[model samples]
Target: MTVKQPDLSFTQNPQWIAERETHWGPIEGFLKENNRKEVVEQLKKLFFTGVIDNPEDVREGFAILYYPLQTAEAWDYLFQDVRLNPKCFKEFMNASLMGSYNEKFFLDDEARLRFFDYFHPATYQPVIKSRVPIGREQKIVQIEVDRFEILRDMAAKFSQFLGGSEVPVIYYRLDYFFSFLDEACDVMDVSNNDKDDIQYFANNFLQRYFKIESDLEPKNRGEQKAFLVRFYNHIANNPVHPSIKAIWQKVLDEHD
Candidate 1:
């Protein structure tokens, strides 16, 4: 017996995309300001009792849902008594297929798959036709979620490096390190073990390689710069683990 495939010819509405883009800018600004309480309150109101009249509201709602600083307990509390319209929720999800920023941290692959399936346009086959095949859509979402998980891990590592102090210079180094890792991974096949190794190296490199003490601020700007210079030079001269060495070489090659 031949099985029939679902028709998936309809693309996301361009109007919805425009509306989401417009709403996203202000929402991003609000989150960047780091007004946690205000953001939380606004999200609670929006999620619990607010009306989502269009795709823009859905985008705004998702922005709140995906904010990085929100803890699991906070999300649980916010969603506890919330009542969502199934139709609107489906529309919101279909319009905002990028999912949440912190989705990987908040939900595992299975949970995310469940989310996608729940809000799947396939359910409303007569009303909507997905431009993406359902199987392919799952893969796309998974890949996007994996990227988010990498970013989430990078943020966590940066926080660990911060260790309660606000230092701008360290952030630049953190960005550089992660950028190198991203670039290197793109150029080479990396396993989970390789990723773990890279992260381990990153944590140690900040303290041991750069000689930046966790509890204390750098004593001198010149010394910190000197340390970075020496570390880079050492890596350039050394034969390291293939995975890590590739990252170092990539960074050095870019600088050169």
Candidate 2:
């Protein structure tokens, strides 16, 4: 059975936005004095509701427009270290400034997906909706569902099961645990409230391996292999996603 993908799709091509006359690309092209008015006119009610394969090119000649200041900052942060949801974008558009530097951009299903894809930063988190209210009178507003942070928290929770300490230990033992973690987080079903349970498992795992610790320290290759072997079997014997299981298999294959 094929999983239905969520909308808000677009091809990621940095070519158009790259090597422009400026570092910010030709972002200012939409704000040209004589051209901006015509550009705004192209933004009909359904402006972003259509598919865009070549995000590098202007749509029917309409360059991507931004509210200038806050919008640019928001997009910078969105695709940068910080992640903001569509509500923040909607709010900026609501109280947009008088000049072109205002962030008055709105997103429909198609444009929202593509826009994020094109300007994607490593931290960008988007929530693609498969179903929404069907109506003519109701307005459709885009909402971003950012689980990236939560997923990291969940990964931390699992990491703690191998440690009596916090996140740094995960990085310390990333080699043994990365595949286990990459697969675990990809499942996306765990919660961040697994601290007590994690401690219980950590104690059991440490004592079983006779590596009892006051604070978790580095594990030797043998100890690491012991845990990964069980982890590999756990995935194989259980009902797991094929994609995740496949990735988990590589760690076992390569490590041996």
Q: CA lDDT of 32 in candidate 1?
A: 49
What TM-score, over all chains together, does every model reach? 0.26, 0.22
lDDT by residue for model 1 (1-256), tens:
1123212122145664454455455555665466565454554344333322343234323532542223323322222222223333334344233333343322244444444443333221213322222221121121112332343344344434334333322233343333433343331344353455444545443443333444434544444445456556655664434655665555445445
Cα lDDT tens digits, model 2, 1-256, are 1222223232123452242224232334444544445443443212333233333333322222431112333233322222223343443222221112222343223333334333222332353321222122222345453333323343444445455332222333333333433333333245535434433443344342333334345644444445545655656676545544554454445445
Taking all chains together, the TM-score of candidate 2 against the true structure is 0.22
Residue 197 shift from truth in candidate 1, angstroms:
18
Off by over 4 Å in 1: 1-140, 144-241, 246-256
Q: Lowest lDDT 10-mer window, candidate 1?
A: 136-145
Clashing pairs in 2: 8-113, 67-101, 67-102
Best by TM-score: 1
